[model samples]
Target: MKETSEKKAIIKKLMKEGKTYKQISEETGIHPGTVGIYGGKLKKAEREKKCFNGDRHLCKTCKYRASGARSGCDYIIHTGNERGCNPEVCNKYERGNRNETKTSSKGK
Candidate 1:
């Protein structure tokens, strides 16, 4: 049997390649739910690493951050909400959606 670290490495690599949870589970003999849990944790860690401002709430490093505006970020104007940043309109969200489409089509 492969070690836990080796399994996690394989899972992360497969995920990065846009593989689905079911595909990863079949290849690694791990449960789909477990694969999803691991992937979620890895994604969170990667997001933290990508956040240059160090604070998720503050938009200091975000490109859409407003310059001396009362609302703070451009996301509010775009979405008409006070959520600061909306992942729905974020580039990262779009990229993830594209990857999901590819993976789903491949699975089918």
Candidate 2:
């Protein structure tokens, strides 16, 4: 088994490169679940460092935010390809109902 420090270093490098938890698990031979803990720790540390830099909206204005259903001004917005927009900053942002259809069914 890799030492704690070594595992942390590997996880940090993979995260910096934007590798997913699954990818990190595959490359590091660590379990997928454990990868979450590792990644979370790395993210926390990064957030702390960045926090000192200023509240540079990591999710609100992130270019990586997806363009569709999953779009919302939250950290999870960047988790996938779904587009997100912050209602507070984005005039185009709309509050969607979970059961609402994207298209009208009047003709159906």
Candidate 3:
């Protein structure tokens, strides 16, 4: 109970400090696999939050925007092996439907 929370806190803190799973495991005596699991969860949560909150555009021109992607920017996400144009991928493409909803709601 208390020990579990403590371990989670330690893992999160170490992860925020840019420590790798192996390094965290070595320092905290937690298994590398366990550290990696927690790290993966944290990273997933962070990505979701970033996407939902919107992010800055990485480039002046985005391939996803140019190609008329509606769901969201898939510049790097949909790429199987080919490298994307911008080194940093952005998740802030304004979906047409979502924009319409926003505009309609504002009128009400």
Candidate 4:
């Protein structure tokens, strides 16, 4: 209802301000879990946003491109235990086909 909307707005702002889940909860009177949930959504949005901030390569080439999703980069997603990397200035770029093993092994 209206109360939920108000809480959502506060959550959005706090998230944009980079407030921690516990901090947002204390300031907004929302539960820490709820703050974390909303914060996660907001953070995902900001991370996957296409940027013109000196990108050296397309996100598609980076392993953190979230290619498994149907919409490609609609939301930043994590693969395995690895956190998502920035498309604009990520120095730890890995290939998308990292899981594919070599089929031939010097059997000529």
Question: What's each prediction's clash count?
Answer: 0, 7, 0, 0
User: Comparing 1 and 3 by TM-score, which wins?
Assistant: 1
Estimated TM-score per prediction? 0.48, 0.46, 0.47, 0.46
Candidate 3 is scored at a TM of 0.47
lDDT of each: 0.63, 0.61, 0.60, 0.60
The most accurate candidate by TM-score is: 1
* Error at 30, model 2, angstroms: 0.8
Candidate 2 C-alpha lDDT tens digits along 1-108: 988789888888888899999999998898888889988877776666655323334444444434567753433433433334433333333344422323355878
Q: How close is candidate 2 to the true structure, as a TM-score?
A: 0.46
Q: What is the lDDT of residue 86 in candidate 1?
A: 48
* Lowest lDDT block of 10, candidate 1: 92-101
Candidates sorted on TM-score, descending: 1, 3, 4, 2
Model 4 regions lying over 4 Å from their true place: 1-3, 51-103, 106-108
lDDT of each residue in 3-103, candidate 3, tens digit only: 86788889999999999899999999988888888888878778656653323333334443333445434444434434433323444443443223222
lDDT of 4 by residue, 1-108 (tens): 338678878988877787878888998778888777777776666655655323345555654454343433322234334335444655555666523322345767
Q: Report residue 52 deviation for candidate 1 (angstroms).
A: 3.6
Candidate 1 per-residue lDDT, tens place, 32-60, comes to 88888889888878876776433354444
